[model samples]
Target chain A: MRIAELSRRSATSIPSIKYYLREGLIPGGRTTGRNQADYDEAHVRRLRLIRALVDVGGLSIAAVRDVLAAVDNPDLPGHDLLGIAHHAVSPTPARRDPDDPRWQAAREEVVTLIGERGWLVSPCSPALDVAADAIAAMRALDQADLLSSLPTYVEAVERMAAWEVAAVLARGEPARMVEGLVTGTILGEILIGALRRLAQEAESARLQGLTAPE
Target chain B: MRIAELSRRSATSIPSIKYYLREGLIPGGRTTGRNQADYDEAHVRRLRLIRALVDVGGLSIAAVRDVLAAVDNPDLPGHDLLGIAHHAVSPTPARRDPDDPRWQAAREEVVTLIGERGWLVSPCSPALDVAADAIAAMRALDQADLLSSLPTYVEAVERMAAWEVAAVLARGEPARMVEGLVTGTILGEILIGALRRLAQEAESARLQGLTAPE
Candidate 1:
């Protein structure tokens, strides 16, 4: 079938299909000279996987590439896949210098704290470190311990890991799992969207109550 | 106090402090020229906010910067913070060719889908589009539609939000909302993780029972 057919069958557009092809994220079909090319079931399957990781999983092109690479490689471990997802969700960028001592200090504190947890995280991203530094300065203003946030974070990470594992299992089969994941991911964003509003509402009320005069 | 002294006081580090200084994410502190500088409380508060946005909010620096900028602008509406956070999670790199048809179609599809949902999303990031495309492909192979998963996600997101909101309200002040967000995010992750494992168990039992009858 042609790209247009694949797009139509897949419920995607021809242009979008071409973009995937250009990115080499999707394999190309056999060229038939002029304006025609042929695709098969494999193309359909690949296109779907590409969409799942990118759209639902919220990964970058590079990140999606790594994930696809792993999924295609039979020897890859499940742990690596999860790690890839985690990395995809938390892609890092370059960093810059801090403006004050306190900002600088916060970076060190978080890195040390995260390190002490023995999670084997890569060196804190330069950007994160910079963010931490700015936070350090902020910490100076109020009297809060930098380490006070740790126990809660640990508890959270554990809970998250459990959730992902359970969600995927509900999928039944790998293909179904991908479907479930894809469905879950988009819905997950909406859920977050609604919840954020909910949280804000409650928080706003609490803030007013707490700060009100007796 | 000097950088080292502030570092000791905050339980943070020196290199991190310097890194933050360079990033321009934080403001400059008092300088004594040659080898002297002063630090204070304001720096501390900033540090905490920075750390919360990065570690807990999972925002990148560029996203964080936009947020900080908006937050600093008293004229800017506060309700938009969540929207910013939402955009922060999208991938950033742009790699599509100017004439890519498939890319354009997929991009339009995603933007339209998100908009139709009444979600106030940021401009489409091409890099994110590619990743989402991969997931889209994978989801096409699944058994369910996007709407099917909403119920589970809605319940989970709301539950977490309730717990988090309750926690903040009980704290006597709404300042811990960042903490509230963190708790909610972590709980969601954990919930997903638990569900993943439980599903696998359920499947195994069902499969075993079905096969045993034969």
Candidate 2:
């Protein structure tokens, strides 16, 4: 296969493919002639993964690069690879004032939630920051009731996370396991976010006594 | 109160507050004199809401404008206001080819999931598209098993959505209800995503027989 076929198969523009190649997001194809290059199945797969991460997962180019590097590194432990991928995919939160009362309260709530759930998360995990930031945002907006159902949400995510870790660990190949973890971590968020919206709509309709129009 | 006060109180920079005013994402304060305007408590609250939506919710400026307009409209029903907010905050997905077998299959899966859960979502809901697009992405990445836990995730979100809707309805004022819904819908996703990651970390550590470093 050539670059043209790669573009056609991946549904990516030729210019975009070239840009990705230049950015080293996708490896260079084999040089078959002075200007012609031959791509293979690996290129196709790589292109698709890049598209999935960027287009659907909303990862930045730099983040994508880091995630790919983690995926390609054979020496990186599976859990550590997941950590890198997680850090890459999640946006860096704006720094919160450590002394703000709302932030302090939210941080305490997060710590309490962890203790109550008995989750073995590190105190330094970025996820705690993400959750606490959200909690502070809710408080600023005066919508504290949103956090009232924290326990239920925790239960739900615990079960899903257990399943995800098991699925990732079940893969025999380290490379495949890393790839699966990356994809699952990023795409799973998209899937869950979308599903939650749909559920809200459905629940809204039911509460309003509205039927889905056929 | 002036622009500086609004900025100081909201913890946003003067230039950013001016930018928001120029962009009409926030209503201008009353013009009391030349090169001066008197902002009030309402302005402070609105600025906070805008920051929460943009900073935490990751909504675009245009989406924020639309959501604010929906919130300001007095005649819009509370539920309808929420609908508008949901539509605005969620990015419009790139159109997928209807003929793509994977997309078609994913669409069917979305419909089937809704039906299985007895959800009352309309066929035209944008959330259906969002969910289907995510499913297609998962399939493209060859991580289709990620969707296998869809049932559990659905159960969780359904309960959360119900709680969210009930909380919104509990607000007596229409404006307050709309604000609460918008904040919950957007910030709630951030909170859940963070919590899910934290849960994954905990589960991974437990499964791997590792303890979090103190």
Candidate 3:
């Protein structure tokens, strides 16, 4: 196969594939002539992954590069691969106001929730900061009563994570497992957020006696 | 209360409060003596909501204004309010290539899922497009097998939205109910995303026999 075939197969543009090769986002094809290089199935696969991260996951090229590096790391344990991929795709946490009483209260709430659930989250996990920041913001806005549903939320996501991990693990091969984990984690968040919005709309309509969509 | 009191009560700075007033994100206070005006608890409340949307929800000032409009629409039924607020805060949907067969397949899958679940989602809901786009992206990346878990994901979010709607409705007042919906919808998405990340990490570590954090 050639770059053109790879492009057609991956649904990526040829110039974009060239740019990825120049940027080391994907390995170069084997040289066959002065002006031609022969690509293979691996090139096609890598191009697709890069496109997915950029177009769907909205990751920057550098972040996609980093995610690819993690994906290619043969020695990286499966457990740690998720953390790296998550950090690559997750939003940068907002600047923290450590002295804000509301922030302190929110952090305490998150720590307490994790403890009660007996989950094995690292004390310094960035997700902890992300969760606490959202909590602190909610508290600042005087939405404390809404936080009462924290237990319900926890239970829901717990079930979701279980199913997600089990599904990914079912892929068997270590390479597929890691790819599944990254794709599942990033794309899965978008899927869940979108689905939740639809469900909320339906639930609101049901409670308000609105007619279903035709 | 005056501007300074509004600042202190809402945890927003005086300049920010002035900016909000200038932007009409909040209503003007009653004018008093030269360079003086009287603010009140409503001012404080609006300021907090503005900050939450801007800071935590990552909404632009214009989006925040639109959300505020939906929030203040007394005649708008609660069912319609969710749609407006969701559209206001959601990411602009990408340009669609209607002829793309993969996208068409993904859209059909979504419509079928909605019908099977008997969810009253509007056919024109932006969320339907969002869900379909995500699914199409997954398919393009050769991760279609992951779609098998869609039922589990849908079920989990159904439970979450049910609890969330019930919690918001319990607030009683129409104003409070609308406020709860907006806050819950925006901030709740953040909370759920963060919690899901944390849960994935915990699940990954548990399955790998990794030790819990002290």
Kindly report which residue stretches of model 1 are placed more than 4 angstroms away from their true locations once superposed: A30-38, A54-63, A93-160, A169-190, A203-214, B1-214
Residue-level lDDT of model 3, residues A70-120, one tens digit each, is 788889887777777677667765587878887778887888997799788
Better of 1 and 2 by lDDT: 2
Where is the poorest 10-residue window by lDDT in model 1 chain A? A141-150
Between prediction 1 and prediction 3, the one with superior TM-score is 3
Candidate closest to the true structure, highest DockQ:
3
Question: What DockQ does model 3 achieve?
Answer: 0.69
Candidate 1 structure, TM-score to reference: 0.45
Candidate 2: tens digits of C-alpha lDDT, residues B61-116? 98788778877888876667768767766777567676899888898999998898
Error of 2 at A85 (Å): 2.1
lDDT, each prediction: 0.49, 0.80, 0.80
- Per-candidate TM vs. native? 0.45, 0.79, 0.89
Return the TM-scores of chain A for each candidate in numbered order.
Answer: 0.59, 0.81, 0.88
* Ten-residue region with minimum lDDT total, candidate 2 chain A: A172-181
Question: Which lDDT tens digits does candidate 1 get at residues B1-214?
Answer: 7888766654556776666668866676798887777878656545555665665567777776776665565553323433343344444434435355654564565455544443333343332354344334334446334434433433443444445445544543222334334333433343333223223222333433422222
**Compared with the true structure, what per-residue lDDT tens digits does model 1 show for residues A28-78?**
799998888999988887777676666666677887677666556666444
